[model samples]
Target: MDGHHHTAHSVFPKVSTTGKKGKDQKSAKSAKKPRKAEVNYLPPYPTGENEESQEQERIQLLTEAPTNPNSNLTRDVVIRCLIVYLEESLDHVLKRYDDADEDSVSQDLTVQRMKIYSIKTNTSDCPDDVGIVVEGMKVLAALGNFPRACSMLLGLTYAVNVANPKELRYTFEVFQKFLLELDCSKLSPKVNSLKNKTASLGKWALAK
Candidate 1:
Protein backbone atom coordinates (compact mmCIF):
# COMPACT_ATOMS: atom_id res chain seq x y z
CA MET A 1 0.00 0.00 0.00
CA ASP A 2 2.84 2.55 0.77
CA GLY A 3 4.68 1.81 -2.52
CA HIS A 4 1.47 2.33 -4.63
CA HIS A 5 0.75 5.76 -2.86
CA HIS A 6 4.33 7.01 -3.73
CA THR A 7 3.90 6.19 -7.45
CA ALA A 8 0.49 8.05 -7.60
CA HIS A 9 2.02 11.11 -5.81
CA SER A 10 4.93 11.26 -8.38
CA VAL A 11 2.38 11.10 -11.33
CA PHE A 12 0.39 14.01 -9.81
CA PRO A 13 3.54 16.27 -9.72
CA LYS A 14 4.35 15.48 -13.41
CA VAL A 15 0.74 16.46 -14.54
CA SER A 16 0.97 19.77 -12.55
CA THR A 17 4.36 20.62 -14.20
CA THR A 18 2.95 19.94 -17.71
CA GLY A 19 -0.05 22.28 -17.07
CA LYS A 20 2.28 25.12 -15.81
CA LYS A 21 4.57 24.76 -18.84
CA GLY A 22 1.54 25.03 -21.26
CA LYS A 23 0.26 28.17 -19.42
CA ASP A 24 3.74 29.85 -19.69
CA GLN A 25 3.96 29.07 -23.39
CA LYS A 26 0.46 30.59 -23.99
CA SER A 27 1.41 33.83 -22.10
CA ALA A 28 4.64 34.19 -24.17
CA LYS A 29 2.74 33.77 -27.48
CA SER A 30 0.10 36.36 -26.43
CA ALA A 31 2.86 38.92 -25.58
CA LYS A 32 4.67 38.36 -28.92
CA LYS A 33 1.42 39.00 -31.04
CA PRO A 34 1.70 42.20 -33.18
CA ARG A 35 -0.53 45.19 -32.28
CA LYS A 36 -3.00 46.45 -34.93
CA ALA A 37 -2.33 49.96 -36.49
CA GLU A 38 -4.92 52.73 -35.79
CA VAL A 39 -6.89 54.24 -38.73
CA ASN A 40 -8.77 57.64 -39.11
CA TYR A 41 -11.65 58.61 -41.49
CA LEU A 42 -12.28 62.16 -42.81
CA PRO A 43 -15.20 63.66 -44.77
CA PRO A 44 -14.55 64.56 -48.43
CA TYR A 45 -13.94 68.30 -48.89
CA PRO A 46 -11.38 70.73 -50.28
CA THR A 47 -8.70 71.80 -47.78
CA GLY A 48 -7.69 75.49 -47.36
CA GLU A 49 -4.56 75.07 -49.48
CA ASN A 50 -6.46 73.33 -52.28
CA GLU A 51 -9.19 76.01 -52.30
CA GLU A 52 -6.65 78.83 -52.53
CA SER A 53 -4.87 77.17 -55.45
CA GLN A 54 -8.19 76.69 -57.30
CA GLU A 55 -9.14 80.37 -56.79
CA GLN A 56 -5.80 81.54 -58.14
CA GLU A 57 -6.18 79.35 -61.23
CA ARG A 58 -9.64 80.81 -61.92
CA ILE A 59 -8.38 84.40 -61.60
CA GLN A 60 -5.49 83.70 -63.95
CA LEU A 61 -7.81 82.20 -66.57
CA LEU A 62 -10.10 85.26 -66.44
CA THR A 63 -7.25 87.74 -66.80
CA GLU A 64 -5.70 85.91 -69.75
CA ALA A 65 -9.02 85.44 -71.65
CA PRO A 66 -9.89 87.37 -74.84
CA THR A 67 -12.60 90.04 -75.01
CA ASN A 68 -16.11 88.58 -75.00
CA PRO A 69 -18.51 88.84 -77.97
CA ASN A 70 -21.20 90.43 -75.79
CA SER A 71 -18.99 93.45 -75.12
CA ASN A 72 -18.37 93.97 -78.84
CA LEU A 73 -22.10 93.61 -79.58
CA THR A 74 -22.88 96.28 -76.95
CA ARG A 75 -20.47 98.73 -78.60
CA ASP A 76 -22.04 98.09 -82.02
CA VAL A 77 -25.53 98.75 -80.60
CA VAL A 78 -24.43 102.11 -79.15
CA ILE A 79 -22.97 103.19 -82.50
CA ARG A 80 -26.16 102.18 -84.33
CA CYS A 81 -28.27 104.21 -81.88
CA LEU A 82 -26.21 107.33 -82.55
CA ILE A 83 -26.64 106.86 -86.28
CA VAL A 84 -30.43 106.38 -85.93
CA TYR A 85 -30.73 109.53 -83.81
CA LEU A 86 -28.90 111.56 -86.42
CA GLU A 87 -31.14 110.21 -89.21
CA GLU A 88 -34.36 110.93 -87.27
CA SER A 89 -33.31 114.54 -86.63
CA LEU A 90 -32.57 115.07 -90.32
CA ASP A 91 -35.88 113.48 -91.28
CA HIS A 92 -37.74 115.90 -88.97
CA VAL A 93 -36.05 118.84 -90.68
CA LEU A 94 -37.02 117.51 -94.13
CA LYS A 95 -40.63 117.04 -92.98
CA ARG A 96 -40.77 120.70 -91.87
CA TYR A 97 -39.44 121.80 -95.25
CA ASP A 98 -42.10 119.69 -97.06
CA ASP A 99 -44.80 121.29 -94.88
CA ALA A 100 -43.70 124.76 -96.14
CA ASP A 101 -42.71 125.93 -92.64
CA GLU A 102 -39.70 127.85 -93.93
CA ASP A 103 -38.51 129.34 -90.65
CA SER A 104 -39.04 126.12 -88.70
CA VAL A 105 -37.39 124.12 -91.48
CA SER A 106 -34.34 126.40 -91.50
CA GLN A 107 -34.03 126.25 -87.67
CA ASP A 108 -34.32 122.45 -87.60
CA LEU A 109 -31.95 122.04 -90.52
CA THR A 110 -29.32 124.25 -88.82
CA VAL A 111 -29.67 122.39 -85.54
CA GLN A 112 -29.45 118.99 -87.18
CA ARG A 113 -26.51 120.08 -89.37
CA MET A 114 -24.61 121.25 -86.29
CA LYS A 115 -25.44 117.97 -84.58
CA ILE A 116 -23.84 116.10 -87.51
CA TYR A 117 -20.73 118.26 -87.17
CA SER A 118 -20.63 117.55 -83.45
CA ILE A 119 -20.83 113.80 -84.12
CA LYS A 120 -18.01 113.97 -86.65
CA THR A 121 -15.85 115.92 -84.19
CA ASN A 122 -16.55 113.61 -81.27
CA THR A 123 -16.24 110.35 -83.23
CA SER A 124 -13.29 111.27 -85.39
CA ASP A 125 -12.32 107.62 -85.63
CA CYS A 126 -15.59 106.79 -87.46
CA PRO A 127 -16.22 108.25 -90.94
CA ASP A 128 -19.89 107.21 -91.03
CA ASP A 129 -21.07 110.83 -90.89
CA VAL A 130 -19.37 111.52 -94.22
CA GLY A 131 -21.48 108.80 -95.84
CA ILE A 132 -24.59 110.31 -94.23
CA VAL A 133 -23.81 113.73 -95.73
CA VAL A 134 -23.28 112.20 -99.16
CA GLU A 135 -26.65 110.43 -98.92
CA GLY A 136 -28.39 113.68 -97.85
CA MET A 137 -26.92 115.51 -100.87
CA LYS A 138 -28.18 112.80 -103.20
CA VAL A 139 -31.71 113.08 -101.76
CA LEU A 140 -31.72 116.88 -102.24
CA ALA A 141 -30.46 116.52 -105.80
CA ALA A 142 -33.22 114.00 -106.58
CA LEU A 143 -35.82 116.55 -105.39
CA GLY A 144 -34.61 119.02 -108.05
CA ASN A 145 -33.02 121.24 -105.43
CA PHE A 146 -29.55 121.54 -106.98
CA PRO A 147 -28.55 124.66 -105.04
CA ARG A 148 -29.19 123.10 -101.63
CA ALA A 149 -27.55 119.81 -102.73
CA CYS A 150 -24.46 121.65 -103.96
CA SER A 151 -24.27 123.56 -100.65
CA MET A 152 -24.49 120.25 -98.70
CA LEU A 153 -21.79 118.73 -100.94
CA LEU A 154 -19.56 121.78 -100.40
CA GLY A 155 -20.00 121.50 -96.65
CA LEU A 156 -19.10 117.79 -96.85
CA THR A 157 -15.99 118.62 -98.87
CA TYR A 158 -14.88 121.17 -96.28
CA ALA A 159 -15.56 118.85 -93.37
CA VAL A 160 -13.73 115.92 -95.01
CA ASN A 161 -10.76 118.13 -95.88
CA VAL A 162 -10.41 119.30 -92.28
CA ALA A 163 -11.28 116.09 -90.42
CA ASN A 164 -9.93 113.36 -92.71
CA PRO A 165 -7.60 114.86 -95.27
CA LYS A 166 -6.28 111.48 -96.33
CA GLU A 167 -9.77 110.48 -97.54
CA LEU A 168 -10.44 113.78 -99.35
CA ARG A 169 -8.89 112.80 -102.69
CA TYR A 170 -10.94 109.61 -102.91
CA THR A 171 -14.12 111.44 -101.84
CA PHE A 172 -13.67 114.12 -104.53
CA GLU A 173 -13.03 111.51 -107.19
CA VAL A 174 -16.25 109.71 -106.24
CA PHE A 175 -18.15 113.02 -106.33
CA GLN A 176 -16.77 113.75 -109.83
CA LYS A 177 -17.79 110.31 -111.06
CA PHE A 178 -21.30 110.74 -109.65
CA LEU A 179 -21.69 114.16 -111.37
CA LEU A 180 -20.42 112.93 -114.75
CA GLU A 181 -22.82 110.02 -114.71
CA LEU A 182 -25.91 112.24 -114.21
CA ASP A 183 -28.08 112.92 -117.32
CA CYS A 184 -27.77 116.68 -117.76
CA SER A 185 -30.92 116.94 -119.97
CA LYS A 186 -33.08 115.45 -117.19
CA LEU A 187 -31.95 118.22 -114.77
CA SER A 188 -33.83 121.54 -114.35
CA PRO A 189 -32.46 124.47 -116.43
CA LYS A 190 -31.03 126.09 -113.29
CA VAL A 191 -29.47 122.76 -112.21
CA ASN A 192 -27.96 122.24 -115.68
CA SER A 193 -26.32 125.68 -115.55
CA LEU A 194 -25.05 125.06 -112.01
CA LYS A 195 -23.74 121.65 -113.06
CA ASN A 196 -21.65 123.26 -115.84
CA LYS A 197 -20.18 125.73 -113.34
CA THR A 198 -19.44 122.92 -110.80
CA ALA A 199 -17.75 120.83 -113.51
CA SER A 200 -15.40 123.68 -114.31
CA LEU A 201 -14.70 124.29 -110.62
CA GLY A 202 -14.05 120.57 -109.99
CA LYS A 203 -11.64 120.37 -112.95
CA TRP A 204 -9.67 123.36 -111.68
CA ALA A 205 -9.63 122.11 -108.09
CA LEU A 206 -8.53 118.63 -109.04
CA ALA A 207 -5.80 119.92 -111.37
CA LYS A 208 -4.05 121.39 -108.32
Candidate 2:
Protein backbone atom coordinates (compact mmCIF):
# COMPACT_ATOMS: atom_id res chain seq x y z
CA MET A 1 0.00 0.00 0.00
CA ASP A 2 2.93 2.43 0.87
CA GLY A 3 4.64 1.81 -2.52
CA HIS A 4 1.44 2.44 -4.53
CA HIS A 5 0.84 5.81 -2.73
CA HIS A 6 4.49 6.88 -3.42
CA THR A 7 4.13 6.02 -7.14
CA ALA A 8 0.92 8.05 -7.49
CA HIS A 9 2.58 11.12 -5.85
CA SER A 10 5.61 10.94 -8.27
CA VAL A 11 3.26 10.86 -11.36
CA PHE A 12 1.58 14.20 -10.29
CA PRO A 13 4.99 16.14 -10.36
CA LYS A 14 5.68 14.97 -14.01
CA VAL A 15 2.20 16.13 -15.16
CA SER A 16 2.68 19.52 -13.49
CA THR A 17 6.14 19.96 -15.24
CA THR A 18 4.57 19.17 -18.66
CA GLY A 19 1.84 21.79 -18.09
CA LYS A 20 4.51 24.42 -17.13
CA LYS A 21 6.56 23.60 -20.30
CA GLY A 22 3.44 24.01 -22.48
CA LYS A 23 2.66 27.40 -20.87
CA ASP A 24 6.29 28.59 -21.49
CA GLN A 25 6.03 27.48 -25.18
CA LYS A 26 2.73 29.34 -25.58
CA SER A 27 4.27 32.55 -24.10
CA ALA A 28 7.27 32.38 -26.52
CA LYS A 29 4.91 31.90 -29.54
CA SER A 30 2.81 34.88 -28.45
CA ALA A 31 5.98 37.05 -28.25
CA LYS A 32 6.98 35.96 -31.83
CA LYS A 33 3.58 36.92 -33.37
CA PRO A 34 3.71 40.12 -35.43
CA ARG A 35 1.33 43.07 -34.69
CA LYS A 36 -1.03 44.24 -37.45
CA ALA A 37 -0.20 47.68 -39.02
CA GLU A 38 -2.75 50.46 -38.45
CA VAL A 39 -4.45 51.73 -41.63
CA ASN A 40 -5.16 55.46 -42.29
CA TYR A 41 -8.54 56.16 -43.97
CA LEU A 42 -9.10 59.63 -45.47
CA PRO A 43 -12.02 61.28 -47.25
CA PRO A 44 -11.79 61.93 -51.01
CA TYR A 45 -11.95 65.70 -51.26
CA PRO A 46 -10.01 68.67 -52.58
CA THR A 47 -7.54 69.85 -49.99
CA GLY A 48 -6.28 73.43 -49.64
CA GLU A 49 -3.29 72.67 -51.88
CA ASN A 50 -5.50 71.28 -54.66
CA GLU A 51 -7.84 74.27 -54.38
CA GLU A 52 -4.92 76.70 -54.76
CA SER A 53 -3.71 74.91 -57.90
CA GLN A 54 -7.16 75.06 -59.43
CA GLU A 55 -7.44 78.78 -58.69
CA GLN A 56 -4.08 79.44 -60.34
CA GLU A 57 -5.22 77.60 -63.49
CA ARG A 58 -8.36 79.72 -63.64
CA ILE A 59 -6.34 82.94 -63.28
CA GLN A 60 -4.01 81.81 -66.09
CA LEU A 61 -6.97 81.39 -68.42
CA LEU A 62 -8.22 84.86 -67.54
CA THR A 63 -4.79 86.43 -68.20
CA GLU A 64 -4.61 84.84 -71.66
CA ALA A 65 -7.98 86.30 -72.75
CA PRO A 66 -6.74 89.34 -74.69
CA THR A 67 -6.28 87.59 -78.04
CA ASN A 68 -9.30 85.35 -77.50
CA PRO A 69 -12.00 86.45 -79.98
CA ASN A 70 -14.65 84.61 -77.97
CA SER A 71 -13.92 86.65 -74.85
CA ASN A 72 -16.72 88.97 -73.73
CA LEU A 73 -14.18 91.72 -72.92
CA THR A 74 -12.98 91.98 -76.53
CA ARG A 75 -13.10 95.60 -77.67
CA ASP A 76 -15.00 96.30 -80.89
CA VAL A 77 -14.30 99.89 -81.81
CA VAL A 78 -16.02 101.40 -84.88
CA ILE A 79 -13.73 102.40 -87.76
CA ARG A 80 -12.84 106.01 -87.03
CA CYS A 81 -11.38 106.90 -90.47
CA LEU A 82 -14.60 105.84 -92.23
CA ILE A 83 -16.80 108.01 -90.01
CA VAL A 84 -16.33 111.12 -92.18
CA TYR A 85 -16.74 109.06 -95.33
CA LEU A 86 -20.06 107.70 -94.08
CA GLU A 87 -21.33 111.09 -92.85
CA GLU A 88 -20.54 112.83 -96.18
CA SER A 89 -22.36 110.09 -98.14
CA LEU A 90 -25.75 111.04 -96.58
CA ASP A 91 -26.63 113.53 -99.33
CA HIS A 92 -29.89 112.35 -100.91
CA VAL A 93 -32.19 114.18 -103.43
CA LEU A 94 -29.79 117.18 -103.69
CA LYS A 95 -29.46 117.05 -107.52
CA ARG A 96 -33.24 117.86 -107.94
CA TYR A 97 -35.50 119.65 -105.36
CA ASP A 98 -38.69 119.49 -107.48
CA ASP A 99 -39.09 115.75 -106.66
CA ALA A 100 -38.95 116.47 -102.86
CA ASP A 101 -42.19 116.80 -100.81
CA GLU A 102 -43.44 117.26 -97.20
CA ASP A 103 -42.01 113.78 -96.41
CA SER A 104 -38.58 114.63 -97.82
CA VAL A 105 -37.02 115.61 -94.48
CA SER A 106 -38.28 112.39 -92.80
CA GLN A 107 -37.27 110.36 -95.82
CA ASP A 108 -33.78 111.92 -95.83
CA LEU A 109 -33.29 111.08 -92.15
CA THR A 110 -34.49 107.54 -92.88
CA VAL A 111 -31.83 107.24 -95.59
CA GLN A 112 -29.13 108.40 -93.17
CA ARG A 113 -30.32 105.88 -90.58
CA MET A 114 -30.28 103.14 -93.20
CA LYS A 115 -26.63 103.97 -93.85
CA ILE A 116 -25.88 103.43 -90.15
CA TYR A 117 -28.01 100.28 -90.16
CA SER A 118 -25.92 98.90 -93.00
CA ILE A 119 -22.92 99.09 -90.70
CA LYS A 120 -24.77 97.72 -87.66
CA THR A 121 -26.13 94.72 -89.55
CA ASN A 122 -22.70 93.09 -89.59
CA THR A 123 -24.44 90.11 -87.90
CA SER A 124 -21.48 89.22 -85.72
CA ASP A 125 -21.71 85.50 -84.94
CA CYS A 126 -20.02 86.09 -81.58
CA PRO A 127 -21.87 85.70 -78.30
CA ASP A 128 -21.54 89.45 -77.70
CA ASP A 129 -23.10 90.24 -81.09
CA VAL A 130 -26.48 91.15 -79.70
CA GLY A 131 -24.96 93.70 -77.36
CA ILE A 132 -23.08 95.30 -80.27
CA VAL A 133 -26.22 95.48 -82.41
CA VAL A 134 -28.27 96.87 -79.53
CA GLU A 135 -25.59 99.46 -78.75
CA GLY A 136 -25.51 100.57 -82.40
CA MET A 137 -29.29 100.94 -82.46
CA LYS A 138 -29.24 102.88 -79.20
CA VAL A 139 -26.58 105.17 -80.64
CA LEU A 140 -28.70 105.72 -83.72
CA ALA A 141 -31.65 106.69 -81.55
CA ALA A 142 -29.42 108.99 -79.52
CA LEU A 143 -28.16 110.58 -82.75
CA GLY A 144 -31.76 111.47 -83.74
CA ASN A 145 -32.07 108.53 -86.16
CA PHE A 146 -34.65 106.48 -84.26
CA PRO A 147 -36.60 105.74 -87.47
CA ARG A 148 -33.59 104.11 -89.10
CA ALA A 149 -32.91 102.05 -85.96
CA CYS A 150 -36.54 100.84 -86.04
CA SER A 151 -36.20 100.12 -89.73
CA MET A 152 -33.09 98.00 -89.24
CA LEU A 153 -34.84 95.85 -86.59
CA LEU A 154 -37.94 95.48 -88.77
CA GLY A 155 -35.69 94.31 -91.61
CA LEU A 156 -34.42 91.43 -89.43
CA THR A 157 -37.99 90.37 -88.55
CA TYR A 158 -38.73 89.77 -92.25
CA ALA A 159 -36.85 86.48 -91.99
CA VAL A 160 -39.20 83.53 -91.30
CA ASN A 161 -39.13 83.06 -87.53
CA VAL A 162 -35.63 84.32 -86.87
CA ALA A 163 -34.16 83.52 -83.43
CA ASN A 164 -33.35 86.28 -80.98
CA PRO A 165 -29.60 86.85 -80.75
CA LYS A 166 -27.42 85.34 -78.00
CA GLU A 167 -28.82 85.77 -74.50
CA LEU A 168 -32.40 85.98 -75.70
CA ARG A 169 -33.54 87.12 -72.27
CA TYR A 170 -31.19 90.10 -72.31
CA THR A 171 -32.06 90.89 -75.95
CA PHE A 172 -35.71 90.92 -74.93
CA GLU A 173 -35.30 93.81 -72.47
CA VAL A 174 -32.81 95.74 -74.62
CA PHE A 175 -34.29 95.38 -78.12
CA GLN A 176 -37.96 94.39 -77.75
CA LYS A 177 -38.69 96.84 -74.95
CA PHE A 178 -36.59 99.63 -76.51
CA LEU A 179 -38.19 99.48 -79.97
CA LEU A 180 -41.16 97.21 -80.59
CA GLU A 181 -44.09 96.84 -78.17
CA LEU A 182 -45.08 93.54 -79.75
CA ASP A 183 -47.11 90.84 -78.04
CA CYS A 184 -44.87 89.05 -75.53
CA SER A 185 -46.55 85.67 -76.03
CA LYS A 186 -45.13 85.51 -79.57
CA LEU A 187 -41.51 85.74 -78.45
CA SER A 188 -39.21 82.86 -77.51
CA PRO A 189 -39.80 80.81 -74.38
CA LYS A 190 -36.69 82.33 -72.78
CA VAL A 191 -37.87 85.83 -73.61
CA ASN A 192 -41.33 84.97 -72.32
CA SER A 193 -39.81 83.63 -69.11
CA LEU A 194 -37.75 86.78 -68.69
CA LYS A 195 -40.84 88.90 -69.27
CA ASN A 196 -42.69 86.89 -66.68
CA LYS A 197 -39.90 87.46 -64.17
CA THR A 198 -39.90 91.18 -64.93
CA ALA A 199 -43.67 91.36 -64.57
CA SER A 200 -43.58 89.43 -61.33
CA LEU A 201 -40.77 91.57 -59.95
CA GLY A 202 -42.56 94.72 -61.00
CA LYS A 203 -45.70 93.55 -59.27
CA TRP A 204 -43.69 92.60 -56.21
CA ALA A 205 -42.06 96.00 -56.13
CA LEU A 206 -45.31 97.90 -56.63
CA ALA A 207 -46.83 99.35 -53.41
CA LYS A 208 -50.47 98.59 -52.62
> Could you say which candidate leads in lDDT?
1
Q: How does model 1 fare in lDDT?
A: 0.34
Question: How good is model 2 by TM-score?
Answer: 0.22
What does candidate 1's lDDT look like per residue over 1-208, in tens digits?
Answer: 1122223333433222233457787876675422222111111112332334545654553443244545434544543443353232222212223323435534444434311221222423432122122222222222122222323443343323223123232222222323433112355444455567768999999999
Q: Candidate 1: which pairs clash?
A: none
lDDT of 2 at 6: 25
Worst 10 residues of 2 by lDDT: 36-45
* Cα displacement (Å) at residue 95, model 2: 29
After best superposition, candidate 1 residue 176: deviation in angstroms?
4.8
Candidate of highest TM-score: 2
TM-score (C-alpha) between model 1 and the true structure: 0.19
lDDT of 2: 0.33
| Alpha carbon lDDT of each predicted model | 0.34, 0.33
Q: For model 1, give the 10-residue run with minimal summed lDDT.
A: 36-45
